[model samples]
Target chain A: MPVNHSRQKRGIAISPKNNSPVSLFFEGAKDTFPLIVGAIPFGIIFGTLAATAGLSFGATMGMSLFVFAGASQFVCVSLVTAGVAWPMIVLTTFVVNLRHMLYGATMVFFYKNLNPLWKMVLAFGLTDETFAVAVSRYSKNDGVPGKHYYNLGSMVFMYGNWNLCTFIGLTAGKAFPGISQWGLDFAMPATFIGIVIPYLVSKPMWASVITAGTVSILAGGLPHKLGLMMAALAGVAAGVICEKVFSEKKERI
Target chain B: MFETGIQLYEIYMVAGMALVTFGIRYIMFPLSGRLRFPELFERGLRYVPPVVLTAIIVPSVLMPTGETLNLKLNNPYLIGAITACAVGGLFKNLLLTIVVSMAVFLGAQWAFAMGW
Candidate 1:
């Protein structure tokens, strides 16, 4: 598969086109730094909770490495501590992560031009943070060269930071047992606000946000974060319906 | 207060969760290549970012533990989040939003702890 090298030589110096792979990678890292800061406490809290839940260091780290979804990992640890059956734990986590399907599908538009190998790698690294950064970048200019390198950069930094914090929490969790209670989790919601608020320039977009936010709270009592899945589905359905209705209204007028 | 052991069943659980999580993340990319989406479906995918993100953010802020359901003035997360959203809208800076939100969160927590 020939890379989209033709998109290069447009000679736009402001875009990723003029940058080297190494420079693009670092640029991605730099762009993602603020989000990573928000993730720091969440990662450490996972470590602390895992340790407090009596999970062995290897098991805790293994969960972080293998599952790699923050909310699901937290749910898995809680369920494991609660003595829930392993199958139930697995099933619940699976349901919680179903949102990744949307992330993957949405990302596929920009990624369609890349080879399968690049797709596979980016797929692994497609967490919410990376998706937010990369999607915004692609939305701005889909033709930027080495954009995949930028994605790789964000992924590597987040991956390392998560694992490192888990280690820190596993070891230092005992020393600072109250760390998780320090209200740091707010950073994540705040980051999402920054990411999503800027993009609500249309009715369908605003409808999606209103629908998803309302449904998420109403469904919060659902087990294993099923509320998240329900809210996401509802929001997408609302957005599509709103888009259709609005377009039809415009056409008729 | 908690039992400490690496039981065989726990290992199985870890592997099972990992496989399923990875499967969900991995399955979509290939399927998108193989299958064709309808025109509306493609358009709907554009809203995925806002919708999914709002879903994640709302519950975390409003009901931090999925149980608290805090909406009062003393709920530092909610107050700080409102402030953060305003700052984010006004400034359009992630670092500033986080910094302001965290500062508001910590400050609110301290203020409430002091009974005012």
Candidate 2:
């Protein structure tokens, strides 16, 4: 009960009995609102840039609706603008989105008992913001049932906001042609810092952040955004190694 | 004829992007209930978010233009990101951190443009 009390202070639900799926859904949306604010500029910039890059309205909207991944959509549009072939565009998309596989792997444990259809729906919305929010929720020891509604809530809210922001950007882009160049995309990195800084509580986590950050900057020139993947792998490996070393030291002590 | 060809090209490209994106995201779903990872692998999974997010945040903050490192004081991105880190660390409030950071970034941009 004390543990639940502390979690409740942190805004997690106290127990399953007090939370209905509908309330959980709303709570999820409310929690995700901050990250959604962070993403608004990103989605709008994508739309403005895609239009500037000469993508048809249909194509731009279709990519947002279908692909639904922010970073990959940006990469795809840039590649298209550069006259890259479709196959290469797709390849870049694949590479840009490979990090989602790691996200999916981390989430699979929580969702292993979920229905396949539910898993499918959630997977479509497993973006950086949604995953960040949902993983924090899932990791809490609050014994809440139907928490997937929370995930669904975050996903639907983000999905709708992204598309709507894209529409606004497309419409406003022609009117204010310089909107995309305003460097408003800084919101994303700012949001990421907020999300990540709270998690740097352990030696392994610090190792992971340092390794990944260094490797990414060092390999920033890699083609097709491969630097991201390299940095991620190096970071994870460093964390795992540090975790092992630290735990072994603790055992000896 | 030319119009139709362009439309077709766009369609093909969008479809290709959709397929690859969805495939990567959904690959682990079908295997979720069926597969179990090793203990070490499971422990390693905990680091994925911090690592991936940091990998993204670092380069984007340090190299906003993606062409060069901008560690100068005039770089709004670097200034704003550092402020965000400090605010987040102290307040641990997401919305407040974002708002304050954006304000700082905008102010920095204006000052730098004025030759400050």
Candidate 3:
């Protein structure tokens, strides 16, 4: 009865009854393009950095494929470079990736009617960027399927792009001495700002960000980048406390 | 380094870390039916920055020197970083942030090289 139940695999959208859903999936893909474009450069940098940190090419790409997690992989490289014990390296990576649990849980609710096979396939691929795209689509369209295809497609695309670019970067980083001095490293912060600024258009969010940024600066010198963690905790704590303190006020858009 | 014998110590550490990561990732699966978390937990999760972003950005900004701010005029990296944040906020563009920060830092270094 739904618009996408038929011709699910071919991506045909012309059926009078089934056009909307196929279009919606493509729509999801279109939305994810920026994220993939983002993946290319970010992946290149990760590869370059991992090599700079002394990881082998096989290890870096393997980490990307097996973990498919950008930041935690970087942390692993950092820990290894610093000669931290292997156990702690693993623990830190796990702790840093804890946010994925929330993502898996939230997206699962959307795909509730789908078979369990699709759920397992998707649960592993849902990263923040894909989750953002999927959540916005679900909220806007209301007819989105309870399946995880969009998340799967986006994640797989990004993962492939990243590994490819990372390999390119790894080769270049090794071949060219002092390559980092050329200033390609600035891409990382700029990317985060690009993402964060759009989210700060709302006032409460503005408060939350400023609080986090300032606190991070204050705690910038803490060991093991723990200050950064505290800053995040502080920022979100501020948001939650502010919301609770003002609960009695009438709700306004 | 560990072609065949990475050592039990290393194995335990890496495997332990892997387990921790797995536990964190599937954190919700075990609790889906067991506990009634307060609304605060849900609210906290929503308000928090995505985990990867927080770990990446926060650590780099706070501890670029490996453990300290490494603050000093000679540390052009810090200047470049701050320039990234300020210019990043004003323009809200990624390319501009990368360009401006790198340019300013390199420009400053150039001037310094010229005895400014």
Candidate 4:
């Protein structure tokens, strides 16, 4: 398992304890708390911006309640504000959210044996922060059963926090009219930096980050935010190629 | 004087976004049991998080305005992101990283605005 392999390489001991479903669930929520902090500004900003974008309070809250993805919601609201057609707005949302497909694929290994209902519920909650927290927990070979409960916990916590923040933003936006311009949106990127920096433990990872970062900046002008998808692909390709090349060199030596 | 709170097109748009977003997220779940990916492809998937996150972060920090690059020292976002990267590298604590970075970001913004 990648968890065991990485832990061994890092000289960290894997805990041998097994956790009950209840504990795992709460642990999931607790571990995801910091990420929720990062997401607060993001959720609130979305609400505030959506309100300003001419989305009714109902529509703004509806997006949070149903769509539940921060980045895509932002894109959708921005497109609406631009006076784009509804179909085009939806298409952009689809494109913006395609990264979640990769997340879903990564998570499939853990949920393959789960019941359909459990799988569906968990999949709906698979945002970037939840995935970050849950994957690290799942990756640990701590022999924990019902790890999906941990995911459920994080999901519920995040869902609640997001909606609450959106509500705050909606109310605050009307009051302050300048809350969105306070640079609060920096929280998301700061949180992302925290997530990514720790994963840069290998050359392939570094290659992936550098390539993706550069490509995203260079292609940032692409229509409908397609640059994000392009940058992601380029980054993954770079990582895979570097991994192969480096492993081949080790074999040759 | 007849006004429903939300317009019909807005409802349609939100519904469409919800459907597609859920479709992307849930598509793999139903197929989970029946699907087995190649090992090479699986390896590539591990890179997805870092890559996707970096793609998002790079643009947000470098182009906070969403229209132009802001690499100058006065750009609080750039300063804050760099602070975050360094702090996270050294400490590896998520909350600490966020708190410290946000403080730095705000401080930078204040200083620049004050002509300091």
* Candidate number of the best DockQ: 1
DockQ result, candidate 4 = 0.65
Q: How high a TM-score does candidate 1 get?
A: 0.92
- Tell me model 3's lDDT, rounded to 2 decimals: 0.62
Q: Report lDDT per candidate.
A: 0.84, 0.88, 0.62, 0.89
Judging by lDDT against the true structure, name the best candidate. 4
Q: Per-residue lDDT for A15-37 in model 1, tens only?
A: 63346788889988999999898
Runs of candidate 3 with Cα error greater than 4 angstroms are A1-26, A52-54, A102-116, A222-224, A251-253, B1-22, B50-116
Clashes of each: 0, 0, 4, 0
Ranking by DockQ: 1, 4, 2, 3
Candidate number achieving the greatest TM-score relative to the actual structure: 2
Expressed as tens digits, the lDDT of each residue in A1-253 for candidate 3 is 4556665533545444333445545655766675665566667777777777766566666667666677677778778879887767776776667667766555544665666566555555666667666665654553545325555556566667777878877777566556545544545654554456556655456666777777777876665556656776777777777766566464642
How does model 2 score on DockQ?
0.60
lDDT of 4 by residue, A1-253 (tens): 9998897655534433336677788989999999999999888888778888878888889899999999989888778778899999888899999999999999988887788899889888989999888888888896657899999999999999999999888877677778777898899999999999889999999999999999999999998789999999999999999999999999999
lDDT of candidate 1 vs native?
0.84
Runs in model 4 with CA error above 4 Å? A1-18, B1-4, B32-35
Candidate 2, B1-116: lDDT as tens digits: 00112377889889998888888888987766587778888888888988899989999988988899988887899999989999999999999999999999989988988998
TM-score, candidate 2, first chain: 0.93
Of the two candidates 1 and 3, the one with more favorable lDDT, higher being better, is 1
lDDT of 1 at A108: 79
Error of 1 at A65 (Å): 1.8
